[model samples]
Target: MNIIDNFDTLHRAATRKAMQRLIPLMCAIYFMSFLDRTNVALAKAQLAIDVGISAAAYGLGSGIFFIGYALLEVPSNLAAHRIGPRRWIARIAVTWGILSTAMMLVQGEWSFYVLRVLLGIAEAGLFPALMYMVTLWFAPNDKPVVVGWIYIAPALALMLGSPLGGALMQMNGLGGLHGWQWMFMIEGIPSVLVGILLFFKMPERPRDARWLSAEEAQALESRAAADAQGHPELTSSDWMAALKRPTTVLMGLIYFLNQVAFVGLYFFAPSMIQQMHVKSPLLVGVLAASVGLGFLLGVLILPRIHRRYGNDCAFLGMLTVGLIAGACAFIATSSPAARMVLLAVTAFFAGGVLPSYWAIAMKRLHGIQAAAGLAFINTIGLIGGFVGPYLFGLAETVTGRSDSGFYIILVASLLGLLLVPLFAKAIRRETEASSPLGNGSAAGMQS
Candidate 1:
């Protein structure tokens, strides 16, 4: 395969300009992704009070979505690989949109549980599907930056979802629907519209993008393929082979460790803050939004940090910083403002290191292999998504303190810092081969 001539020298402006068209769409999709999933967090206090769902039951419902999400991941990824991303992604968005809207209809614990499961089923492989699409557009060295962009979607979601959710909750008795109902109705519409947009506007591959000139498309495709040739495991389409890789298992572990802290804290952030004696929905929204803002700020500065610090140093450093900041929550237990600042600091590190972690993972997988490997990794990691909230709720129930659950954040950060280097060491040769830092191409990364 002919590598794109001067891929090492591709102009940063050229690459950025090309991606500018596609990433905004992805960011929008991710905005919907997190919004639909976590909007429930915002609605939790009112929904529980209205529907008589217990704390444990609510946690179960929140986490149950990931069960369906995990179970169907490989299958969904295989389907997406076979059918193409536009159709599969659009299909996911529309179905999940319907389910998300139907959340307003939840009348009891069982209804809430059922809808959560269904929502999970609808969103099963969305992440892997999008990851597969990214491999088609970007080179290995570029995947981290791309990963950062996708996450900015969630960061933006928090910024928007918190305020929107708070405001909508004030609309109680509108059309005989609660404010939470209105929130669901309004938030769910954007997803369906995005689905329609995906079907009509999203291209299956670079070659199919009408807006990209032939030279641009070829450059993207050639560079992507060139990176894959050095490591077939990085882009192979074989799902079974992907599942069997040791690295696949390790990457999943890393994600699981990370999520054990992040997702659980996130799922209950608003109500937990309320437990600090703060009652205003608008204030809760603002505080929650700050954590997301921290995430966005971290991602915005990440590429520069990675360039300056090297990926390994940058990765471990963020975890250490987050660990210190997160543990401070226990110290600031009485001060809501201090707690928010600490959580925001924790969010910064969690968000900052994600791209580097994904960059390492993507270096070893691409295409169908990437699809299946990512699905498997995500499937396992999402166990944390399920476990985090439920476990937090259980812990909170047992300990009689909402803040008790947040201790997991520090534990997770410590584990990640300790385990990541070992995982990287185990795959030393592969990382060296694919890592721009190892090959002295770090300066060429953005280009």
Candidate 2:
């Protein structure tokens, strides 16, 4: 019993050490990625004046990044599996950073679209690669919380990036560059530097981490192996089968709808706030940061809820509440302050969904399938990243009302809410089938 106790202590120590060493670095890297992705929103009005980009064109340019992203995601994940995440992620960050910085050179719509797509290509596979790394380094029980931490990067990016982007935008006419140009240049440079940091700092796997003692490393590896036991590594032949699984497909669809609401808000919230007659760029950014703060609160609050209610309960509950908040944004259209408040409320609950969704999705995936399946789901869902912005743009341009686009958010949220029951049922079934006692006995026990 003492020996067992000692082992448990060592395991906990290793997990703690790994989290301390890794999570911050990973979050920093992802924070840069998301900041670069969405900072375009802050630059939209300037782009229209300086670059002749229309609302529709801006939407397409903002979202077309995902087109390049989706195309390369699977290939990139497979390559990461082969070459190691440390190197692959560094390559992605450097290339995307270079491209993000180059946004300063946009001469017209074509250049804008091309640069955004290239940036997407450069950043492709990053999220799934990070998710794959989590599977390699952490045990099943620790994954949801770990993923929750990783998801915080985007919220932080928005929370901090909005204000930072605003401040940078104030750099207009400094050194003969527009404020947006300055924003891109300053923001993009750090990612390249961070990429360099990652190449040197990131370990390929838990067993390779020099910070961990040999016994601790062994404990981590043993825990990971045990976690992977039931879900065997998929061979190439089984790759398509794994991707085609009903649960995977359903989760992808759910994420797609969620992204429709989430990404739309990410790309347009600044403009939406601008429509509220608040003319100052910095003020718009500061107000926009409120949404990020709401999201940050949600991400921070979810793990406690998860601990108390379990995964399914936490996931469905947050998603349902989030969707409701999102739908209510439509009703707040008459009041700018109310609209902003609803947007933040929507973000707060929406923030919880990503971590919770992945927490459940990760359980059904292991080994090579974890990489492939994650990329596949992300690829499908990211297409909505494109759809959301494009449709919102189209809606706004056609109707000439900024808030009119909330109709899309309303419909998407309702559709997402309707699908939650189906997703919950599927997850329960998968969990039952995978348990030690098998599906029949698990069902019997539940009954």
Candidate 3:
């Protein structure tokens, strides 16, 4: 065979490997991404004396991670867009791993603050880059499930990582190192290894895959072309225009409010369990794991629900149910059943949101336009993401009760409930005005 034929054969093989490679890679990295992000939660609860950080200081430390994360969020993603995900993602993973392991050295509030900030900086690119990669590789029809799968990472981390975190933290005999320090060291090391592995495995883009045949590459390129038809070429102006759109703004607001509830619960859930008279850190981990179970179930079920009710009804109904259940949980903190019910409801809704959000965005946007749009939405959303945990911690410090944070979440959930309707109205109008594409196809993605 000629060189051209050899290239074609290789490209085809690479294309075939994409889905299998992509899903597992995303799952593993994000699992560590989450574990690294919340190792501090475990640390705060159990390593308090070891770390020498106060509760209020802990909240500040938690919130500062997001500020650090927020500072670089857009820029890191933009860099990923410019440099491609493989190298940038590897850099992020390795950097976070080093910083996370260094948490062992933190002896005071200042060191903890510095380390958390570094962790945030390390994590900045991950989610936006993942979303960007998905847009590059998957068709709009296949996006919901793929995105849903990626979104399951955090949940799985909670389910699996939580118990593991508790166990590692109990490793105080492994030198003079504290349990909390070990938590960071153990959680962060695997990410560094994964980063090295990513260098070898993850492709820069679909076209860069050397294992795909010419026919396969052409097919993938064609699918991308068809999806690009209705969308304007991605430009700075286009990005600005998308942001200026009332609809985009509405979606951002809704996501922001939603994160306030979701992120707050995640950061504080362990502490909440600890305060509920559950003396065992392992037991607290188990309860938090339940939320993770809810998340997995939510992602698994959203496709069927979407097929049944359509995106608009599915989303609005989920938010409404979420708001009600969230409120009940906050109000009935004394009742374990009520609190668990609320946490499950919240996780389910949170889990389902990413898939629907991506599905809607994919149907509406394509190419770099989708990447920029996801970045923008996520950037705005992280504002709340950053705020939620800090506010929760701060509120708990001030009030001496962590339940106040949940009540705050209850209010934010209501805001999310209110915003979803407006988003639906605007989206419906946009769809009606434009040529609405129905459910996209797997073939449609590879067009």
Model 2: per-residue Cα lDDT over 261-333, one tens digit each: 7898878889988988988889889999977987887778875566455446445655666667666755656
Question: What ranges in model 1 sit over 4 Å off?
Answer: 1-14, 232-237, 311-314, 317-321, 329-333, 429-447
TM-score of 3: 0.87
Give the candidate number with the greatest TM-score.
2
lDDT per residue (tens digit) for residues 94-120 in model 3: 999888888888878898889888888
Poorest lDDT segment (10 consecutive residues) of candidate 2: 438-447
Ranking by TM-score: 2, 1, 3
Count steric clashes of candidate 1.
6
Taking all chains together, the TM-score of candidate 2 against the true structure is 0.94
TM-score, every prediction: 0.90, 0.94, 0.87
Quote the lDDT for 130 in model 1.
Answer: 83
Q: Candidate 2 at residue 73, lDDT?
A: 85
| Error of model 1, residue 379, in angstroms | 0.9
**lDDT rank order:** 2, 1, 3
Off by over 4 Å in 3: 1-17, 225-229, 232-237, 428-447
Regions of candidate 2 where Cα sits further than 4 Å from its true position: 228-237, 311-314, 428-447
